[model samples]
Target: MEISDSKKRIEELIEQLNKFAYEYYALDNPSISDKEYDKLYDELTILEKETGYILSYSPTQRVGDGILSQFSKYIHKGRLWSLDKAQSFEEIIEWHNRNVKAVMQYNKENADKLPPLEYVITKKFDGLTLNCTYDNDGIMIKAATRGTGEIGEDITAQAKTIKALPLKVDHKGLFEIHGEAIMTKEAFDAYNEKAEVKLKNLRNGAAGALRNLNLKETAKRNLSAFFYDVGYNEGDPFESYIDMMKFIREKNFPIDDYMKIARDTEDIKNEIEYINSIRADLNYDIDGIVIVINDMRTRAVLGYTIKFPKWAIAYKFEAEETTTELLDVEWNVGRSGRVSPTALLEPVDLGGVTVKRATLNNMDDIKRKNVKIGNRVFVRRSNDVIPEIMGVAEELENAREIIAPSNCPSCGSELMLVGAHYFCENTLSCKPQMVKSIVHFGSREAMNIEGFSEKTAEQLYEKVDLKTLSDLYKLKKEELLNLEKFGDKKAQNLLDAIEKSKECELASFIYALGIPNVGKKTAKDLCKNLKSLEGIKKATYEDLLAIEDIGEIVAKCIIEFFSDEKILRSIDELLAVGVSPSYEETLVNDQSSFMDKTVVVTGTLKNFSRTEIKDKLEALGAKVSGTVSKKTDYVIAGEAAGSKYDKAISLGIKILSEEEFLAMI
Candidate 1:
């Protein structure tokens, strides 16, 4: 009722609620029920409204944080490029109304014989949205992050290493394929354990993984990919939208599996809701659902805005909120033994999953969040990535005290202050340390043992004396399936994967070693100079330092690799298990002059029209754009001369009239 009292209540609510969040959302362990948490969340909301106690820290105030990071800038296939973000059912209906109106404006006779504006809706993945370009021969020419839809960094070399990314496609002509780069839930958790940082929420996790400068770490993360569609195909040869996706998939592109064909907008909306309901269980990441008219001709007629295609719209799911009470804060130790303080809370249901605990981040975060025990908090899930403690409602400042731990809870090791991270130097001996090490070794990037996940690997190592990668090769399938959640199917997949990975190259094998500072590139360089894994055993620090990008710290880590008994034995054991490190020479970089160019662009194009213009311009190499520019060498304007026409004339830039476009052709 009073201001101070309201503040106290809000603070108390924050603490109680955040504890529940930390337990349920972040930890995947819930201690309470949904009904109970929601009641408290409601009470906080009602009290705040009635008491006029608008605490800035109110749980209801904090909505979702940033979703995707800044996309790279690039040329759009069309001049108008803006994406649709649907936050509610009403918004979707509004979009639907607009889209239907756009279609109605078309000729009825043209529409009658045609397939009802076929709409294909696929689950929107919550990962790094990437664009891959392929030549007619199916050879991947370039891979890029979706920069502002205009220009993107050339990540061809890095992209090639992702096993899931298709190196060659069956489809011909210039096509822009779009998809998500991700780490599966199984792999992400295991990696987060070893990296000792709470895995970023999935989308963030995947983005962070993709953008990491060290390709070895990226590879080590076992980043998987899923290709959705050929975003653009200049030829218009594919008569049907389904055919285009099929062509993409036939070429072994990773398409989202949770796709369904819907008959109408109603079906689309229902399907979207259904997909959102099952998103938590799905592997990889999904944020919303994308609906696009299946008719390519209709799509062309429909066209698009600067952001989103007119025929395609994304029905983003709303923030599913649940309430919980913060019971206590627990100091958690990661593989790094960073003492991250977690809020242990009462259980709450979010997105159908029972959530009780959530991440309080760190002590600084705890203080900043100001959520203490006895506070009520609400947590929201964004695309199954991670949950955040939005805010505290009806707090109780003095209700209870939650503080950081002075020592590692997993082990008795004293936690020393190291930057924001609390480090415990206990290696291999600490339970979390030992568990994470075993898990990392068996991780997909390393030995890629199938049945081995972070939890399974930890239990196997501790219970069966599974100490190293060698120990894993020795584990019997029967012995593994006997563990928790290890069914016959999973066990077989794991064993089969392990058997298949018995033969590996120097880069992968070196990456599996878990040595700091040595990644895929460093490993490749090490092998390039040494020629064999065994050569690393005999190489001096000076030899390692001679290689570029290999610093003293990395050289020391490599030099110590031979001296460390466990690492040395791990390599030998892998060799014994028939995992040989084969080395290969790296390819020279490709430098086609037409690679970078900038120019105004527009209109319906013929021939490799866009692609050929791109190729030739790229060859003689020029950059083509949708909009005309001031320094435009050639305004390659096709049909429908619009604003660019006036702009070009005013600028006095040379305009390649359709006649001129044909002449150039």
Candidate 2:
């Protein structure tokens, strides 16, 4: 075929494949079989290569070239503000009354210059918020997280993997669209079935997929996005949000049909009640309902607060609860060596999903609740995400008392009581603890070992001499192939991931160490303060206490952790095996005002959001803490500073206003 003919054919094929992908992945209805789609895709790819003519909107361009070294921050065209939450009907009424008073006074003053006020209520999706930007050419240039409202992590490549999201739209002239990236129940279960490590919840599933640098893995999650608001657009602005919704719908964007306009507070309340009744029947999870002023004029008049819009509010629903028979209690060991009880039950449908198990917390909780095996228990699911056993509902006459295990199930070691929980002190020998630790070490937020799985950890532990964490670095492809279900591609991929993890950042390496009570945030704080792993190891308890949020207990834990001879040996082994942890150079500042200071930000600030201020503090070589403590050097108080300000004042910590903070910086 001629090049001209090939180009025409490729364009047609690309269009057809895009439609097919949308139908299959987004609409959940496949018009074409996978084989046929693949055939067409292959044909188009070959034609593009042969003719040297590739369409920007081609299906092949959906997957990016390779993994990004690190995600770059993208400044949003406009700030993305959060919504104030209203938990009760009374709070909603109070907000409605305030709106009524404002609109009434405005109409009285201007003699009805503004149109009648109305509200639009839609379900609040419990998923990751994404901002998609389309340039003047109608080409999607970027998709970002709602990082700090003003700036976000660019995930354009990962966003393209969402088949529901349009790679190229018909009309774009600098449009910034807001949407929620969510994973459906079907996709979540399907992924969990094949995945070695299961996703805990749908929210995390969507968030994790987008945050992952690997576009291929992001595609595997089958994320779907529903666009709602036009945050920024150079085109003629819509008179009302409803008109904007119509425009978005015309552009073939995914918008839920559940958006309802309410004329009054009663209408709003009724709509909310209707939403609550059908929430269980919905495909995706929603934590609450968002009520916003529909008219652009009214929204402008109402304006916005520093952090949240005054014209909008979120009404959160109560936690979903159900009762089921507790058949047994299964104890699991965590990376921190803590042994926790999980209640295995007769499957009971709750909030559209069947929950067969729930976290029983600890032995103290079980004993306090008088929980027993074979007893019907009340299980509560928070936001349709985490399941927890609330208490026993019905006690069976034959119910057996739940007894705490005297010995660790994985290592046969003696169980010791630590505060309210039981722990297996044998962290090195316990299979569950060791395996979990290895898995955590290789987790996406930690060492980020690509393709790492619990099954791989189990195989390495049982079959190979993978006794210590250092043994992971010592793994060979040949030995991995000896394990069951191992393939050449899989083994090589894992090995490459292991090698890549050796060059991880200092914060991730510290987090991967699985230190007790040390999370990602704490690890970052430690790294920012200590500057290196060596500094952390050599730091005394007093030195650790100087860091933000590091109290006497946490300080003691850090000192104890580094004091362990085994941990030192493991560190030496890792270093010997060529593992190198790296840290970025400190940011240059005109004045190092906040250097070596521990700062906490409270309430809404005029210049920066909570996250942005924290990042700024960290960038300025200061440790930004979450709480007000005795170690805190300064507290940046914004409008409505609330209890943190009170606590800081009580503790005699220095307080700085937003202007004062800016001046200091």
Top-TM-score candidate index: 2
Candidate 1 lDDT (Cα, whole model)? 0.66
Task: Quote the positional error of residue 214 for candidate 2 in Å.
Answer: 2.1
Q: Write the per-residue lDDT of candidate 1 for residues 526-586, one digit (tens) a residue.
A: 8767888778888888888888778888888778767987666667777887776687754
* Least well predicted 10-residue stretch by lDDT in candidate 1: 62-71
- Taking all chains together, the TM-score of candidate 1 against the true structure is 0.42
Per-candidate RMSD, Å: 23.3, 28.1
Give the poorly placed runs of model 2, Cα more than 4 Å off. 28-36, 320-665
- How many steric clashes does model 1 contain? 74
lDDT tens digits, residue span 423-450, model 2: 9989777888888888998999899999
Q: Evaluate model 2: give its TM-score.
A: 0.51
